[model samples]
Target: MSEEPGPVPAAAEPTGDGLVQVAYLHPHQVSHSWHESVMRLVMYDQLHDARIVGTAGPLMISCGSGSLVESRNLAVSRWLDETPYEWLWFVDTDMGFDPDTVDRLVHAADPATRPVVGALCFAARETHHDGMGGRRITAVPTLYRPAHDPQGNVGFTTLFDYPENTLLQVAGTGAACLLIHRSAAEKIRAEHGDVWFDRVRYGDGRWVSEDLSFCWRLGALGLPVFVHTGVKTTHHKQVWLSEADYPRPGGGEAAHGR
Candidate 1:
């Protein structure tokens, strides 16, 4: 089989060894209006305090989703092609990450022994109050919305002792606060062309979803993942899920399993 393309010549300023590059995926200009504002908050409050060492370069950001999931993924992939770092993260611009989150991932554990984690996503619970019937307080998670367990299951912030670092049947992850190791990022890029997710525009004339596609592909590869609750961030929106969004499986649908 052909190997994946080599990484672009990595920059040396940000220190690429444990260099964690975050891609603040924000595809506004269609749905929400506070997108760019959230991006600025992240840079000023969180990523700005971040630092890495011993490998390539500094952090990166991309805010070109353009209200379409496909276009947004394109922006992220473009960053991956040009970003020079050992690790990559994808967070929604609205999510506020821990200032020292990069430092945490860099020294999580010795690289030789641990399953090079595909991602380490932060955790947060969003309270969605529907303006109509009573109050529909939804639990909007920051990352790794592992619904495959006892139904309505969110994730953890601290890294658990999981085999291969993955939750079983995890549907997808929230783009709020996702951190990916470079090794796994390379593997993902090899399969899916790059950090930019494949585009799929539905009848609404907008690219619908790609983060789930990206996570599904990674999970299939048996890459480890973690729920880093320490790094709390917000999704910054009050959008609730419709049955159309998260439909049940066939055969009347069983609850998510462990």
Candidate 2:
């Protein structure tokens, strides 16, 4: 697609009570050969599914991680601030979410609970005692910890004691998948810069991790990210093994660019 910045008005409308804002992180991060078709059939089509329920509609934004987090993350943030919705779902290109996903996610959240602003965990964390604090929680075995884990060493939870369903202040949140409420995003942008995904390799703390720094900033502000264990969406990355590469019914092979 186009490389320009700013929010692209979604062709769809809201199907649910929540304002769904789907943002793609590092569309360029994946291998180009599978980029176009994957996005259209999977990412785009999935969002389109919500049209039946009025939970559809999102500002599609693509940005390179590092510096100018404000300009990047805030592009959508600004658009969202101008909108009337309360909850905003920030998704990467890898995410596969639909109306059912939205409906279920909202149900998973506690109505009596105050607003939470943290990374939504589709992948469940292993629980020992169970607790919630600082508005964050870490997976028992996070997808990344294994890669960095010592050979044969069972990695432990970075922070312990969290509620089964509650807002957790995690050390960092991944842009790969996160559901941010409008008030939460506004609070975050005011404190830190913008949402950084670390798409760029050659950068410092601010350059490399948007999700990471985002949680830190949100936690610092005491905004807990409400963890919805029930809601989850498939994440599609730019890779040969990605499920998004699967062909559509009655279709040929997936093309490179859309």
Tell me the tens digit of each residue's lDDT in model 1 across 55-127: 3433333355354455445545654677656565554545444445444444442232222322334334444
Q: List the residue pairs that clash in candidate 1.
A: 11-56, 14-57, 16-55, 16-56, 17-55, 65-72, 77-196, 157-228, 157-229, 165-225
Candidate 2 lDDT over 1-258, as tens digits, reads 111212211222223355455454454564333245244434443565442134445554555554336544664555555666656655555445443544444444332232432334344432333232322322331212111234443221233333443333343445544555566667756665455322332122223344555554555576554444334445433222233436765786666776
Predicted model with the maximum lDDT: 1
Q: After aligning candidate 1 to the native by TM-score, how far in Å is the CA of 37 from where it should be?
A: 11
Off by over 4 Å in 1: 1-16, 27-68, 109-135, 140-172, 199-209, 239-258
lDDT of 2 at 52: 18
Please list the C-alpha lDDT of all candidates, in the order they appear.
0.45, 0.43
lDDT of 2 at 193: 45
- Candidate 2 yields a Cα-based lDDT of 0.43
